[model samples]
Target: MPTSVKIFDTTLRDGTQGEGISLSVEDKIKIARKLDELGVHYIEGGWPGSNSKDIEFFERTRTMTFKNAKITAFGSTRRKDSKACDDINLNRLVDSGVQVATIFGKSWDFHVTTAIQTTLEENLNMIYDSVQFLKSKGLEVIYDAEHFFDGYKNNAEYALQTISKAQDAGADWIVLCDTNGGSLPGEIAQIVGAVKAHVSTPVGIHAHNDCELAVANSLAAVQAGAGQVQGTINGYGERCGNANLSSVIPNLQLKLGYSVLSDEQLKSLTSVSRYISEIANMHMPINQPFVGNAAFAHKGGIHVSAILKDASTYEHIKPELVGNKQRVLVSELAGQSNVLVKAQELNLDFDRDPQKSKEIIEKIKEMEHQGYQFEGADATLELILREAFEGLEEIFTLESFKMLVEKTANHAVVSEAIVKVKVHGETIYTAAEGNGPVNALDNALRKALIQYYPDIKNIHLSDYKVRVLDEKDATAGKVRVLMETTDFSSTWNTLGVSSNIIEASWYALVDSLRYALLGRTRIEREDKDQLEQLGVVNH
Candidate 1:
């Protein structure tokens, strides 16, 4: 069996320290459950005594059962003059009802002398008393030597003494923290190796990313006999953020041969990263390592050609292994292989018709030169390809549309739109009012087609983004509209470009509806085919 390195996720406690990150109690619980599902060994819940929301989180999560991760409450050691048993922070950790307690104390002499204004001996006493008190309470104690790296560099003997005190007090794990996040990977390895030699207790590492070396330093610590790794999902934390567990886990499991999470649990890494980002209402970094959107995306002609032959030619690892897929992005740099790969991914048959593939490649290059980006709008690209090769017919034809906006003297504005559509050669006209012209237009168009295709009601636009093609041209510049729609089954993006923003938005909206209707039609046809196969119906 391979060595198992424990994964300690501090997203709830340390991650919220990042700017603009505020997690409600409910959000904390949701994230805890998700982290549990992702197979983290330990989850550091926030300081119970620091705030009411964190207190509430501990209270609510007391009843919630986690499968693999043990909930750990985080806090500092006993205060300057307080005994461990009488410390309010230590009492809150006990009341939090977590099985593990992780407490930090000043390891650096500078912090002990200046920040805490306490004697070096008293800080050592604090570490010993706190860990022993927690251990006496039937709670596992993990002592965090705050600023351990900086402290070790300044006074190695005193820094080693702090960890030694915790180890003597029966600390289960003594974690060396690069709290300042200034140490490089080589320095981390040397310090961790020295600590391993000095302390008998199991060692762990907590790294920050001020130098973009958090992940590197973490892996280095592991190589130097640190049994536990502490980080956050997506590297969320204060300053530059902590080491990203999404990157660390894979590096340990796949690259270093250390088992952190099971292969099956590791597959959820990308989804878990995205889920946290969604809950935080933050944009997922498309270029983040391992779990990012562009992790396995190929665009260059030579790269795409080689990747199509064998994915490993350009990719470091199979994307599906990390819950991601290889994306052959269509752009001006795309070649015939890029078109073929993208077409195949969309379930379009272009293998037998090489001419159609060339046409798509040419068309994409031309559109890209005209400032029409298709990389982010796969649904639009699929529609164009289907129309060219599969002979996809228009589900509905737009006859005409008119939008009206009226503002009265009282300052109340009313927006209404009327849409005319031809479905199966029958003309339908519908009008609707909304808070804005775009909403009104969307309502009117959907109302016109609802009777003919009731499934259109299930499809609703989730996101709409508009960008100016050329800012120098100002009002004369063309606008690109991207619409993301979902029908409970899947989400897809459609795009349109025009000088008029309304026209561009209308075009994207229409394509979104048509794409959804096309999916419904295909499913219905498949259902009919299955029935015919069972001899229940005849064509």
Candidate 2:
């Protein structure tokens, strides 16, 4: 068995400090459940005494049950001139009902003198008293020496004294935080090694990413004998964010051969990362390491050919180990192998017909030249494959559509759309109103089709983005629209190009619906075929 490093996730506490990340108590609980599912050792719930929302979050977790992660409450050391026993913050930590308590105290003499406006002796007293008081309440105290790295560099003796005080006061784990996030990896390793020499208690690392070295510094600290790693999922925090646990966990487990999470738990890393991003209403960084969408995607022609032969040619490790799959991107720069690999992944049989594969590659190059980008729109690519190779049948044919926009006397604009389509030779006409022309068109189209395909209700547009292909043409320039739709189970993107924005949006929207309905029809046909082969008669 490899040595185990405790995975301490501070997504709820530090991660919430990220801009545009605001979680309701419910959102925090949902995320906490996911973290527990991921087998994190400790989850810093939030700063209990700092806000009512955090207080309510802890209150809600008391009724919940977690199988793996221990809930920890975070706060600062006792305030100036306040006794630890009487401090409101310390008392709130005890009342938070968490088994673990993590509190930060000033380690830098500058912070002690200027930030806290306290003497060095009083700062040490605060650290000692707070840890002892929390321990007296039967809580596991984890002391966070804020700015320990910078403080160690400035005044090594005083920096070591803060952690020593907590150690003597029964701190379970003394964590050295690079609060300013400016320390390099080399400095972190040397400082952490020095701290281990001074304290008998286990040491941990809490690093930020201002210098883009949080993950590097964290790994460096671990190499220096730190047993616990602190980070936020997707690196969500203030400034440049904290070290990303999505990257850190896999590195510690697979790359370094340290046991941080179980194999099953490790596989949930990608889902956990996306889940947090969804809850935060933030776009997951496409290039984020280990868990990003493009992490294992091959694009270069030579790279794709090599990857098709052996993924090890370009990939560092099997993406499936972390619940991510390898992707072969098809584009103008892609080779014939890229087309074949993508076709195979989509269940298209292009192996026996080399001409069809060549046709797809040429068609993609021609389309890309006309402002059609298929790289981000897999559903659109699948549609093209089915049409070219499998001979996809149309679910519905559009007859005509009209839109009307009217502004009231008060300047409130209202848009309405009428759509006409033929489903199995039956004409369906519907009308709807919406806040905008595109929305109205979406509503009218759905109303016309929902009667024939009830599953259409499950499909909703999640995102819509538009880009002008030629900026020099200005108003007359061609525009490209990318639309993302989800059917509750999976999400897909489609692309459209036209001179008119509404026309572009309409093309993408129709493709989205057609792709979804076509998939359902195919599955139904397959089921019917299977049943017929099994001699089951339908009444």
Candidate 3:
């Protein structure tokens, strides 16, 4: 029988600590419920008394039941010289009605002497009394020895003594934290092994990603006998970040045979990861482990061919295991199998046209050489592939456009934009005013396009970003514009770059609209085909 590991997720707590990630009470509750459904062993809600949102979460979460997971309230230990029962923070934790309590105490001498302005012994007392107090109140207490790894390296004996204090005081679990995230995997395993031998309580590991080794260190600690792993869902935390439970859970259970979530539900990992990213309004890390966009994507010809024959040749785990679909990308370096797989994904039926496939792939690679990364934006890439094979309609074209900006008497900037377009021998000229020149131009373009494509009304610009390619001289650098757009159902991103900001924006705007229209068309066709197959429609 495989040993079971507890997956303690702290996304709502630690993830929100990420700068600019301030989730409301409703958001936290929503995420907590989803995590419980996903079978996390524990969900670390935020410190109730520290913030209003967290306080609201505690109050609201009391009424909800997480079927599989224990809801944990996270906070620091009671202040030095304060009785645990009387400490307002401790009372808040109890009143919160959380079944579990995680209290952090300074383990590093530097933090004790400098940050907290307290003696090392007083910190130990704080950790011990807090754990004992919470445990006595019938809550499972987890002692977080903040900066434990660094403290252990600095003063090995003191760090051990602090953990011993928590264990002796009734902490159910002792979490060793790499707060600075500077420890390597080998060092982590060795230290965790040592800590396990010394501490009586079950050891858990909490790591940060400063060195980009939080996940690796957490796993190493588990291999070294830690039964619990604490992390954020998408590795969200302050500074570099905490360990990513999404990666940790899969690696521990699938790669190491330690039971975490249900084996069947492991396939939902990708969708879950993307869902959290969407909720947080953060860009999903394409290269994230196990469930990332590129986790199972094949690009090179040799790799694609081998993957088609035997996936295990290069892949460590099956793509479907993490709910991630395998992507055989078509580029100049792609083989026949790459083209076939790409075509199949797009529902394009082809009968072994190696020459045609090669030509299309070569064209894609040539375009990619001109600063287009199709793999990064699959929707745009899919459009390009379809256009190469089926030829896209021009429908409408940009003829000439001019924008004028004027500062009003009230110092508010007014933008006026005019556009002229010829659509199938019909000339349409439109003028619009907007808050800014870009908005004006955007309005003008939309005004012109909606005449033929009324569905364009459903398209909305979600986000726009501009980056300078070269910063050697601020005045002379190429600029890149990235635009994110949403239609009825899905979202897509497009990129364009030029020396001129307007030109770059225009390219990205047009491509973003094209991607949306193309996706809508594909979805409609797919629905029609499904209806036909179900005998609801006939050709």
Who wins the TM-score comparison? Answer: 2
Q: Write the per-residue lDDT of candidate 3 for residues 2-115, one digit (tens) a residue.
A: 188998899998888897677777778878877887888899988978888888888888888778999899888989888888899888888899999998988888888999
Candidate 3 versus truth, CA RMSD in Å, comes to 3.6
How would you order the candidates by lDDT, starting with the best?
2, 1, 3
Q: What TM-score quantifies how close candidate 3 is to the native fold? A: 0.87
TM-score of 1: 0.96
Query: Which sequence of candidate numbers ranks them by TM-score, best first?
Result: 2, 1, 3
- Could you tell me every candidate's TM-score relative to the true structure? 0.96, 0.97, 0.87
Note the residue pairs that clash in candidate 3: none
What stretches of model 1 exceed 4 Å from their correct place?
none
Looking at model 3, which ten-residue stretch has the lowest summed lDDT? Answer: 368-377
**Reference-based lDDT, each prediction:** 0.91, 0.93, 0.84
For 450-532, candidate 2 gives per-residue lDDT tens digits of 99899999999999899999999999999999999999898999999999998898989999999999999999999999999
Candidate 3 residue 14 C-alpha distance from true site, Å: 2.7
For all the candidates, what are their Cα RMSDs to the real structure? 1.8, 1.5, 3.6
How far is 352's C-alpha from truth in model 3 (Å)? 6.4
